[model samples]
Target: MSAALALRQAIHDRLAADAPLAALAGAVRIHDVPPADVAFPFVILGEAVVADWSTATEGGTEQSLTLHAFSRAGGRREAFALAAAIQEALHDAPLALAGHRLANLRATTAEVRREGDGRTYHALVRFRAVTEPL
Candidate 1:
């Protein structure tokens, strides 16, 4: 699957699994999958960690998360929520999707694909955010 598609699925799984998602949704901002590295500020067990995007496919698409995530039990809700919200915002970003922002959004399943040495994954979805629409 395309990185964008995988991204969409990853975001959905993360959001659906996260309980704090309602609060973290405000900080999400998705961007285009560039050839360069991208970092995500993820919180684990109440601590903040940066998830990096480094692995890309031969098609010039990246699925590997550049940010390193430590192993932690529970609190997945917070992490998933944060990741989903950010992805949604980036996928719908104007600079990335451009004229196809609204059209590019997939309300159905998310895009997910496994790549690399069985250690990395990538998604094609991107989104931007601004807290909740309050």
Candidate 2:
């Protein structure tokens, strides 16, 4: 499978197996990628109120989460919390990597943005995971 597809599946499987993520139900859409980054759809696994995954590099990947809710302002807290939950969910391999575990998952940035007729709290978490070469 392609790196992106593999990354997506790994994320889905990990989240599916996670108790926290299992509470929601929705297929994670592999949305956009800018240069070296892979972005997950605003809606992931279900009503998680957040989307997240890792970068599919040749060697490894990096995890990230974005929040979507009623409005960016109102969703900020939920987003931040969900992002951390995602990080915790992928804390093992092959969900993560041998040496790669979530080193950080925090909202360093946020925005109150509009989504259709409503608004939602949007936040970003910086995920850092590392693994040795196979």
- Compare the candidates by TM-score and give the number of the best one: 2
- The Cα local distance difference test for each model comes to 0.33, 0.41
Q: Which lDDT value does model 2 have at 23?
A: 42
Off by over 4 Å in 1: 1-29, 33-35, 40-106, 125-134
Tell how far residue 47 is off in model 2, in angstroms: 20
Supply candidate 2's per-residue lDDT for 21.
Answer: 40
The TM-score values for the models, in the order shown, are 0.25, 0.42
**Tens digit of per-residue lDDT, candidate 2, span 21-105:** 4343233322233234323224332221223343575354343434332213354555555555565665444454233343333
Candidate 2 global TM-score: 0.42
* Runs with alpha carbons beyond 4 Å of true place in candidate 2: 24-75, 96-118, 125-134
